[model samples]
Target: MIIDLTTRKVKRVVKLPKTPFGITFDGESLICCCSGKDIQMISCTDFSCTNIPKTLMSQYSYIAIQGDKIVCTVPDDSKVSCLDNGKLVWEFKNESVLKKPGGITIDDKGNVFVVGMDSKNSLMISPDGKQYKQIQTKEYGLTEPSTIYFDKIRKQLLITNINSFAHLYDVSFY
Candidate 1:
């Protein structure tokens, strides 16, 4: 998405990070990784934004929010966790399982969806931090997934493969 600074309209947008960035939409706010450990949220009301800290500034790579909680992904550490207000609510670590964890998203029911670069299976987690399902998209050619989003308006899950094309999945549950 291009950010219009009123005086000019920027194009070919980027997140000012050496590595790729992660993003998520929580209906009311647009959340993005700050290249640091925390994520930044742009308020839908006035376009104002503030950072959500997660211990330090380089502990995370991406973030997603469920309700008022902010859930972020840490690749090198192979984990994901959430911060409530300003305190850590929960943390999960599995180096053998979540290698290079990348994109993340949250459903209306607070189910978390995440994709990893070297993961044999994408993951789903309950709001309480219980991993529920593992969805394999290898058959669909998703070898190195980068981004995932639950599009409310289209009732579908949009996924982007690194340096590749994007695919849409029907997730209407209808």
Candidate 2:
């Protein structure tokens, strides 16, 4: 459903094939992590829907746009992947600390922020996808965090916990 924020009215309503969980815009279309085990692209101009074939996994939990690729978190496999042109371009190594990755976001520098659901923390990947750093320790009060958002303007990170209020961390120290 599209709403006109200026006039506060409903503009159009288009039904989707499945419930969208993680979504991102690639300038021209909206990419969604649909329940049908595929990435759905909704046209920004006409609201047309297209399902991209799933080639890497059975389900994708969260997604973020990283340059020309889409990085997605695979909860069931405890992995994260980058897809380009409906094909798996890269896959993060399945590490024990990455058990059940949920939320994901990428910064302008291509750094990846991913939620470690089982670890109750978040992992940061370098622009080259080589280095991994764990941030927001238990002492900082993170529990069952699911969603992550990066504020480029303020240089802060906002994370949502399933059972508690959202947490904000200043990333200016980085």
Candidate 3:
């Protein structure tokens, strides 16, 4: 559902074939990670939806936009992938370590950050998708972390988890 923040009213409601988990805006469209092996692209202007196929993933959890590319987390497969208008570009497979790849956010520099639902750790991949790094660990005290977002205003990385409080990581470190 789309809402008008200033008016505090619902502006539009979109129907989908399956549950929409992760959502991101690519300037002109609302990209929804659909439950059943698909991503829905909805045009902001007309609210028209187009479903794109995801043959590699059984389920989708989170998604992020890095410029014109779409980075999505496939929890069931414990993998992350980059797509160009629905075409595969590059992918990272981590089924051995990452159980359920969950929340994902991309920094302005295009670094991709993703969390694991059961692993209690976050992974960071280079903007070009060549370098992979494990970021958050138990020492950071994250418990079942869920989502992450880069606060452009404050220039920090905001993380939320099962815990009541949210954690803000200084962006400078990365």
Candidate 4:
């Protein structure tokens, strides 16, 4: 079962905090992060919204569900955080790599994958964010990746290179 938000019937649209870089469901509502800063939690039943944790997170480009944890990509730095109870329990940092990373996804096994602009490869973080792998394909990237997702059943990772292209690749391991 797949629900395409772009073509599907409008469930609802609650206003966001800023540019709304990424979104993920939080049982009762959808938590949308706007421009790496504010988080707006919108009700699934009516799309009503409220702020979660009562504090803005660090600047991030994307967020997604990695098991029960939330994987968030922090900006201006090559680091991603797996958060719990408003604290980062796991972190992945690369000082001399990754540039302008924008999108992220997680597999059913809880492996984390992230993409950045102008690169053919994306970073894959383990469930604990302690280990990482690089996911790449010849046709998929080496460009700008604005959006990305993992297809659980097929074990395929999809990359939406927003510069007028999209691609799919088999991601055997994260």
Q: What are the lDDT figures for the candidates, one per model?
A: 0.69, 0.80, 0.80, 0.69
Question: What's the number of clashes in each of the models?
Answer: 1, 0, 0, 4
User: Candidate 3 clashing pairs?
Assistant: none
TM-score for every candidate vs. truth? Answer: 0.75, 0.88, 0.90, 0.80
Q: TM-score of model 3 relative to the true fold?
A: 0.90
Best by TM-score: 3
Give the per-residue lDDT digits (tens) of candidate 4, residues 1-174.
Answer: 124578986554456667675777756767767663556667777767677573365555677864457777765666677776566688787754455566888888888888855445587877887787666643544466777888889998788876667888887643
What's the C-alpha lDDT at position 138 in model 1?
62
Per-residue alpha-carbon lDDT of candidate 3 for residues 107-174, written as tens digits (9 for 90 to 100):
88788888887788888888767778887865687787888888666778887887656788887753
lDDT of 2 by residue, 18-120 (tens): 6778888778988888765677788879989888876333454888885577888888888888877778776786566678898999877788899888878
Candidate 2, run of 10 with poorest lDDT:
51-60
> How are the candidates ranked when ordered by TM-score, highest leading?
3, 2, 4, 1
Candidate 1's residue-wise lDDT over 99-128, tens digit each? 677777877777777777777346776777
